[model samples]
Target: MTSLSGKNAIVTGGTRGIGLAIARGFLEAGATVTICGRKPENVQNALDALADYKDRLLGISAHVGKSEDLEKLISASEDRFGAINVLVNNAGTNPYYGPIVDSEDAAWDKTMEVNLRGPYQLSKLVARKMLSSGGGSIVNISSIAGLTASPLQGIYSVSKAGLIMLTKVMARELGRQGIRVNCICPGVIKTKLSEALWADPQAEKQAAAMKALGRVGTTDELIGAAVYFASDASSFTTGAVLTVDGGMVL
Candidate 1:
C-alpha cells in the first residue's frame, strides 16, 4: 500500500460514493483528510460513517462552484491540518441525460460549474498554497466517458474531456514547481452518481457486458489509484491519466 503518512489531503464532493471511499482510504493510509459536501447534513453523515477515523477526519459543508466557499474550505483545512499536500478534485455533476443539442443552458452551466470550473478554480487556490510549500500532488477524477462521448451524457462528456486536458495543462505548468498533477479516468463504477448507468437490471447487465472484466467495479477498487497519485509512490509521475475501467471500451 502507498503510504501517505503525515500528509494533509482535501477531497471534494466527499459525502458519499467515490469521494467518501477515497477519504476513508486516505485516513487508513495515515493522512489527515478534510472532505467537503454541499449539504451540512450530508457532511455530518459522512463524518459519522467515517467515525473510526474521527480524530484524523474533518468534514465541511461547501459548494465547489462558489469561490468564497472554496476559499473557506481551503483556509479552514489549512488552519486545522497545516498545508495541504494532496488535493483530489472529485466533485462533479451531470444534470442532463440527453443529446447535446437538447441540453439547456442551465444544464450546461451547472455541469461545467461543478465538473470543470470548480476544479479549475479550486486548483488555482491549492496551487498557490502548494507553490509556497515547495510542492504537492493533485489527483483529478475524470471518466472514460470523457475519452469517448456517450449519446446521453453529451454535456458531461464534454466537461470531463476538458478535465483531462486540465490535468495535463496543470501538470506541465506545475512540474517545475514540484507539484505533480495527474488524472484518473474510471469506467462504469457502481456509485450514486453513476447509478443511471448500472442500477437497473438491464442496465447493469449491459454495463457489465461492455467491460472486459464482464462486470462493473465498486468504489473501493479505485482507492489504490487515488492513493498512488496522492502519495510519493508516483513522485516522478505527472500529467498522466490512469484508467481503471475494468478494460471497458475507450
Candidate 2:
C-alpha cells in the first residue's frame, strides 16, 4: 500500500465525483487533504461528507481557472497544512457538445480555460511550493477524449488534448526540482458529469459495448492510479498518461 502518513495534498474540484473519491483515497491513506470547489456550498457539503476524517481534511471554495482564486487556494492550503506535497488538478469543464465547425468561440474559450489553462497555472504555482518542500507529485485528471477525437464534444476534446501536452511539459520542466507530473485519462465513468451518456439505457449499453472489458468504469476504479501517482509508488514516473478507461482504447 502507498502510505502518506506525513504528506499533505490538495485536490481541486473535490466536492464530488472523481475528485471526491481521490480526496477520500488520500485521507484513507493517512495524508492531510485540502479540497477546493468553486462554490462555498459545495465546499461545505464536501466538508460535511468527510467529517468522519476531519483530522485530515480541509475544504475551501476557489475557482481553479481564475488566477486570484488559485492563489487563495494555495495560500489557504499552506496555512492549514504547512506545505503541499501532492496536487491533483482534477477540475475541468465541458460546457459545449457539438461538431467542431458549430462550436461557438465562447464555448471553445471556456473549455480551454478550464480544462487546460487551469491545470497549467495551478501546476506552475504548486510546483514552486513543491520545490521548496523538497519534492511532490501532481496528477492531472485528463480524459480519453484527449487521446482520441470525440466529434460530438469537439471543443472539449481539443482542450483535453492540450491538457495532455501540458502535463508532459510540466513534468519535463519540473523534474529537476523533484516534482513529478502525470495525467489520468478515464473513459465513460459513472459520474454526474457523464450523466448525459449513461442516463439513457441505449447510450449506456452502446458505450459499454465499445470497451474491450464490456463495461464502463467507476469512480473507484480510478482511485488506484491517483494513489500510485501521488505516492512514492510512482516516484520515478512522470510525463506519463495512465489510461483508466477499462480497455476502451484497446
Candidate 3:
C-alpha cells in the first residue's frame, strides 16, 4: 500500500466528484489534505461531510484559473501544512459542449484557463516549494478526451490534450529536481462533470459497451492511481500518462 502518512496534499475542485473522492482516499491513507472549491458553501459542506478527518483536512474557496486565487491557495496551504508534498490539479471546466466552430470565445478561454493554464501555473508554484522541501509529486487529472476527441466536446478535448503535453513538458524539466509530474486520463467517469456521458441512456450505453469492464467507472476507481502518483510507490515514475478507462479507449 502507498503510505502518505507524513505527506501534505492539496486537491483543487475537491468539494465533489472525482476530486472529492481522491481527497477522501488520501485522508484514509493518512495524508493531510487541503481541498478547494469555488464556493465557500461547497467547501464548508465538504469539510462537514468529512468531519471524521477534520484534523487532517482543510477546506478553502478559490478559483484555480485565477492567478490571485491560486497564489492565495498556495500561501494558505503552505501556512497550514508547511511545505506541500503533493498537488493534484483536478480542477477543470467545460462551459460549452458543442462543435469546435460553435464554441464561443468565453467557453474556449474558460476551458483552457481552468483545465490547462491553471495546472501549469499551480505546478510552477508548487514545484518551487517541492524543490526546497527535497521532493514532491504533481498529479494532473486529465481526461481520455485528451487522447481521443470526444464528440461535441471539441474545445474541452483540445484543452485536455494541451494538459497532457503540459504534463510531459513539466515532468521532463522537473524530473531532475525530484518532482515527478504525471497525468491520468479517465474515461467516462460517472462524475457530475461527466453526467452527459451517463445521464443519457444512449450515451451511457455506448460508453459502457465500449469499456472492457462493461460499465462506466466510479470515482473510487481512480483513488489507487492518485495515491500511487502521490506516494513514494512511484518514485521512479515521471512524465508518464496513465489511462484508467477500463479499456474504453481500446
Candidate 4:
C-alpha cells in the first residue's frame, strides 16, 4: 500500500463522485484528509459517511469557484491539519451542453469560472502555502475531452484544455520551490458528473466500445493514478498528464 501517514490533503468537491473516491483513497493510505463541497449539508453528510475515520477526516463547505470560499477552505484546512501536503483540484462544472455556435455567454462563463478559474485560483493559493511549509504535490483533475473534442461539450472541453496548460505553467514556475504539479485526464469514468454520458444503455455501450479496454472506467480504476501522483512513487513525474482513459485516445 502507498503510505501517506504523515501527509495532510485537501480535495475540493469531495462530497461525492471522483472527489469522494480520491478522499477515501487518501484516508486508506493513512493521510489526514480535508474534503470540501459547496453545500454545508453535503459536507456534513460526507463527514458522517466517513465517521469511521473521524480522527483523520475534516469536511468543509466551499465553492471552489468563489475566491472567498476558497480562502475559507484553505484557512480551515490549515487550522485543523497544520500544513497541507497534497492539494487536489478536482471540483468542476459543466452548465451547458450543446453546439458551440448555440452556446450562451452565461453558460460559457460559468463553465470557465468553475472548471478553469477555480482550479487556477486554488492552485495558486495552495502553492504559496506549500512553498512556506516546504513543498507538496498538486494534482489537477482534467478530462479526456480536453485533449479531444466532443460536439455537445465544447465549452467544457475548452476549459479542461486550459487546465492542462495551467498544470504545465504551475509546474514550470513551482519546480524551483519543490512543488510538483501534474494532471489526470480521465475518460468516461462512472461518476455522477458523467451520468449524462453513461446513464443510457446505448450511450454507455457506445462509450465502452470506443475504448480499447472495452469498458467504461470505474472510480476505483482512476484512484491508483491519483495515489501514484500524490505519493512519493511519482516524485520525478511533474508537469505530466497521466491518462486513465482505457486507451480511448488510441
List clash counts for every candidate, in order.
0, 0, 0, 0
- Candidate 4: list runs displaced more than 4 Å: none
Query: What residue runs in model 1 are displaced by over 4 Å at the alpha carbon?
Result: none
Q: Write the per-residue lDDT of candidate 1 for residues 1-250, one digit (tens) a residue.
A: 3899999999999889899999999999999999998999999999999999998988999999999999999998999999999999999887899888877899999999999999999999999999999899999999998899777999999999999999999999999999999999998889888898898989999989988899999999989999999998998999999999999864
Q: What lDDT does model 2 reach? A: 0.90
Model 1 TM-score (2 dp): 0.98
User: Which candidate's lDDT is highest?
Assistant: 1
Task: Tell me the lDDT of candidate 3.
Answer: 0.92
**What lDDT score is found at residue 191 in candidate 4?**
83
Residue 249 miss distance in model 4 (angstroms)? 0.9
Of candidates 4 and 1, the better by lDDT = 1
Residue pairs with clashing backbones, model 2: none
Candidate 3's residue-wise lDDT over 1-56, tens digit each?
Answer: 49999999999999998999999999999999999989999999999989999999
- How many clashing pairs does model 2 include? 0
Best by TM-score: 1
**Given candidate 4, what's the lDDT at residue 118?**
94
Model 2, 13-74: lDDT tens digits are: 99998999999999999999999989899899989989999988989889888999999999
| lDDT per residue as tens, model 4, 1-250 | 3688899999998898888889989999989999999889989988988888999999988988899999999998889988999999999888888999998899998999999999999999999999999999999999998999977999999999999999999999999899999999999999888898899999999999999999998887877988888998888889999889999987
